[model samples]
Target: MKAVLPSITSDLDQAERDLREHGICLVSGVLSAEQLADVRAGLYRAAKLDNRRKLAHSGRRIDHGESNQHVRNTLSLDPVFADVAEHPAALRLVRSVLGWPALLGNQSAFIAMPGCEAGRLHADQGFIPEPWPTLPQGCNVGWCIDEFTEENGATRFVPGSCRHHRPPGEGDEEGSVAAVAPAGTMVVFDSRIWHRTGENRTSDQSCAALFNWYTRPIYRTQENWFLSLNPRILEGASDELLTLLGYKTEGFGKVNGRSPM
Candidate 1:
């Protein structure tokens, strides 16, 4: 595999700044060709695992007819996925946007149905009952494993939608932006931004890995990652990464009572 950058710098700095201001940023070619291949290999491996099954839960389920598959808890399934989850470019961008001391929350793989229709437009952070202007809570990184496009059901977002206090209505004339990129490009955006999965008009299933990050210590993650991790995975992870994955929660006292033991 190719060597990863310690952090994103120079032109990426400007791109990050623009994302912070607009509540969304798209970084093309963030994942190298080798890295992309590794991710694809890992995903295909996970998909083929007998133990790796589809989630029974239907709320987030996509209508795949015979092939609709939504796979979860991938971090524990393979080390290759763990590496991609903690990719340097993704980590650097998360830190730059949310400030230091962020952790991964709600990591999963989305394998969508070819003819699936559009999903409801809503902000991931809307579930939080707290008032506005609070510290930045979380953001999500969408790693395109396959080519994303309007025809293949790419994610749609409304620019500057993060500033809205409530979810957008059905009649709202939202300015839609499709996350169109080749395999390996990653899209990072604030959790507060309004977005939805677009309809898939093609025969191929759209696949992407979703990695969410948060600055606060105590919020419930989108995925229960602790229950999904194993000792071997923990041993191989970096100190910073271990903490991000909830292996060691030092500063988490601000949210969860007492440090994570």
Candidate 2:
């Protein structure tokens, strides 16, 4: 079967190498059935809220009939997603890629309806200059909510293209491959890799995946966590997650010269 670094059974150094060599990897069994069930329950509740309110208040757009409906600012939505964001293997890889003291850049749910067009094949670092510098900017972890098939928009990406340092060429996609994996898998990819969502070709079908973006802690997050997040969600958060969300008192996240207590 076609694959891209399937279900990492190797050591972490090897997994890190795989991330550099393949620009992506899939770690299997990141979530057990019970945890998955809880996440789904929370996601359904949030999706229903988004669907009803149109996600207008979240500082992100939610078009009524768009092919891809993104539930942005998901960290502030519910607590079950915390399990996915702070997953150990994923954090290890993201920290290795983005360097120590990494931070959560953003998290969201992507629901792709059938016939969704191919997203632009681009690198996540494009927000910076071309020929990206040596330092890693960010990485992405996609928590699969359903079977990710080739025809179900299972993340199309160029293999070994992390070294490209720039946007992909027109012909690069001709060799692109789908990240086919099971529902409970974590799809990890470097921000520099060239990727896009594959078109969903099935009828009366849709696919759902969660994006948990992590970075080197200096970059501005896509969503404003300080103001948007519900304070109640922080009642039982772990220290690692609190830090990832920039609850620390130092650096850019500092509040009025006061540090995180």
Best by lDDT: 2
For residue 258, model 1's alpha carbon misses the true position, in angstroms, by 11
Which portions of model 1 miss their true places by more than 4 Å?
1-10, 50-68, 213-215, 251-261
What TM-score number comes out for model 2?
0.88
lDDT of 2 by residue, 29-147 (tens): 66889987887677767877888987723443422236777777777766777778998888898877876677887888877778777777777777887658865588999888877
What clash pairs does model 2 have? Answer: 249-259, 249-260
TM for every model, in the order presented, reads 0.82, 0.88
For model 1, residues 116-194, the per-residue Cα lDDT tens digits are 6676677767667756554446778887788877787777777777777555778643577677766776778777778
Best-performing candidate as measured by TM-score = 2
Distance from true position, residue 80, model 1, in Å?
1.9
* Cα displacement (Å) at residue 106, model 1: 1.9
Task: Please give the distance, in angstroms, between residue 86's alpha carbon in candidate 1 and its true position after superposition.
Answer: 2.1
- Give the poorly placed runs of model 2, Cα more than 4 Å off: 1-14, 56-65, 250-258
